[model samples]
Target chain A: AQSVTQPDIHITVSEGASLELRCNYSYGATPYLFWYVQSPGQGLQLLLKYFSGDTLVQGIKGFEAEFKRSQSSFNLRKPSVHWSDAAEYFCAVVGAGGTSYGKLTFGQGTILTVHP
Target chain B: EPEVTQTPSHQVTQMGQEVILRCVPISNHLYFYWYRQILGQKVEFLVSFYNNEISEKSEIFDDQFSVERPDGSNFTLKIRSTKLEDSAMYFCATNRQFADTQYFGPGTRLTVL
Candidate 1:
């Protein structure tokens, strides 16, 4: 079955520290990966997406992710964490084969807490 | 930038009552979708609509759940009978085309009593 895994349920980082959130996916074919952020009581906002080419993709709010085909991982990274950056992050994948239809399979989200 | 919009930021409905959640997707988008996120859970896909018909739907979308475009620019999801388990945040999203980026609305919080 096509699925996404977010290993961490919660992460804590101090302001000005670097942060990394892990994400892995299982699919038969090349996958379309996306990272979304959801603030409290707000809708999910697209942070970045990787469709094809350029394994390293840059996203808004100084976020970036690298897609590793060999490991089937698309992990998000940030060089510096800010108090406002604390939120829930989700990793999702779109199956590209016959069963795929633009529907996203999301993993259990990772919650980030930044202390000032 | 155009963003998807949903009506009634919050709705409280009684059990067995029918409720319709309305949305206006981004104009010029060809694909529309509805998803729900139960509190403290991952967002789950409900259904996708294109060309005035459903392109795909998850198992959770059963006989009780229906989606309609009704007219231009408006998409709606109707649940025939509400249940306590039905309480969740419903989000409406749209994309210009398949395999493209999707923009989501603020979401409607449905509370079934």
Candidate 2:
């Protein structure tokens, strides 16, 4: 079955620590990948996306993601996490063609907790 | 920067009652989509509308669910007879074209009791 998986349900780190969130997808072909963050009582905000070209994509709020075709992974990372970065992160994928086109399949999401 | 907007940030309704969630997508956007996220679950796609008609829809978008752009500005998702399972955060997203980046709205939290 084609799906997106975020292995970590919850992650905690001290302020200014580096962070990495794992994401893996099972699909026949390469799909459009994206990462979105949601603050409490807020909407989903686009953090970054990967379509083609560069394997490492940079997004807002000092976040970046690397797409590894061999491993079917698109992991998100931040060099220095801020307290405001504590939120739920979702990884999604959309097929590049055929019946699955434009239909976004999202992962279960990983919640990040930042401690002062 | 343009953003999508949804009305009635939150709503509470009894089961079997009808509910219409509204959204105002970016004016320049040409495609619109709807998705729902249940508590502690992944977001699921419901439907997509283009040129005033549904171009694609998932199994979740059944008979009870309908979408329309009645006034050419406001996009709406109507659930004829909502069920308890329908309680979730419904989101509206739009993009200037298909296969492009989509902008999602703040979302409307629907609580069906």
Q: Which digits, one per residue and each the tens of the lDDT, describe model 1 over residues A30-55?
A: 89899999999999899999999999
| lDDT (Cα, 0-100) at B30 in candidate 2 | 85
Identify the runs in model 2 with alpha carbons over 4 angstroms from their true place: none
Model 2 chain B worst lDDT run, 10 consecutive residues: B94-103
Docking class of 2: medium
Estimate the TM-score of every prediction: 0.98, 0.97
User: Candidate 2 i-RMS (Å)?
Assistant: 1.1
Each prediction's RMSD over C-alphas, in Å, is 0.8, 1.0
DockQ winner: 1
After superposition, candidate 1 runs with Cα above 4 Å error: none
**Model 2 error, position B113 (Å):** 1.6
What does candidate 2's lDDT look like per residue over B1-113, in tens digits? 88899988999999999999999999999899999999888889999999988989999999999999999999999999989999999999998866677789999999999
RMSD of candidate 2 to the truth, in angstroms, is 1.0
What TM-score against the true chain A does chain A of each candidate get? 0.98, 0.97
